[model samples]
Target: MRRKKLFKMAEVLTFENVFRDPTVIFGKWKEFFGNDNDIVLEVGCGRGEYVIGLSEVYPERNFVGLEMKGSRIWPGAKKMLAEERKNVSFINTMVKNVFDFFGEGELSEIWVTFPDPQPKPCRAMKRLISPRHLEMYKKLLKKGGKLHFKTDNTMLFDYGVEVVGADKDFEVEVVEYDLYSTEDRADLAEAKLVQTYYEGKFSALGEKIKYLRAKI
Candidate 1:
């Protein structure tokens, strides 16, 4: 393994965070944060740009970046630890196994920032915003909790809007086909200012970042 990869194994929460017995973690999130603050999740949190950056913006709530790749999760995890951020954490796990960690009604919000669009017609189920993930999130989130999805892929953006719109269980709160167009919505506007590494690359190539906020 590389030096930085070694560092990630030693410093951040990896597979070790999950005990061999998954049942032991039932409803233990508040204890992990050492408080009952509202927890925010960033699924597929690549490089943890949204997790670390937004955790700073909203200190009262706790943030957890869920990513499978240790290398991709290393930078933000290290930075958060160095800064001594109490409200932020990361987990090395696949997005599909989210239920293995969190309990029902335990999460406040979920942010799926620039997730894989899975644009291929045959890969619709692979998209992060697919119904399978939505059903999973619905069980974890508190009543009226929010799920935010932002992406540069037009196909993914439209798919997410259609999925959430058709689903009566969730209400689409804010729909911004072009997130950077205006600072109209305070929360969404604040989010736009913090771009992830992938987002920056896409922005430079003149891609219009799309956004949608859904309440469940």
Candidate 2:
């Protein structure tokens, strides 16, 4: 575990990666990934297993996982480094600082998985899928880009859908309240389900997974 912590500390990226001026490097992702390709973000990417899985599946698209906790960011960063996957990277920063790093319409897609619901109404702003965060996502994603959300909490899923539906700019493209019980959702099952370790744990307990896709 000590060795693992050491490695995570080494891989965690900060302002220096973008020359300490995130706003200046906006829309210039090729400088970091070494190629001009679609960029995708996984917000609140705990353990980062799902985003790492996506980097493996979509070699042509660059994937960046934003995680504040170095310990949780370790496994995915270490694995990508060992595999020499240039398309994958991890950013150690707060989600609120996201705009400081990326520019408008710079990202192709975003994935929000198992984020804390911040159940209390007063703390709801802390939720990653809150209305504020959705607006932030709107500016980053390219036209028609999609935002995918998955969670085991029923309350969080319902809240996210309600927020998306109320927003005039976003359209709820898909909804799957019980993923396992649903049938023939090849669109979700085939590629969108980037199941992570946490997901497996919840599934083992027979929890039903909920999902929603919002088009921006």
User: Which candidate leads the pack in lDDT?
Assistant: 1
lDDT per model vs. reference: 0.81, 0.80
TM-score, one value per model: 0.90, 0.88
Off by over 4 Å in 2: 1-7, 10-27, 190-192
Report the lDDT tens digits of candidate 2 across residue range 63-161: 888887776777667677767888887777789988878888989899998888789999988899989999999999999898989988888889999
Error of 1 at 83 (Å): 1.4
* Residue 112, candidate 1: alpha-carbon lDDT: 89
Sliding window of 10 residues with minimal summed lDDT for model 1: 13-22
RMSD of each: 2.5, 3.0
Query: How does candidate 1 score on lDDT?
Result: 0.81
Candidate 1 similarity to native, TM-score: 0.90
lDDT tens readout by residue for model 1, 1-216: 889778765556443332223455557777767888999989988898897887888888998888877778777776776677888877777887788888788899999889887878899988889988889989989998999998888988999999988888998988888889866666776558579988998999999999899888
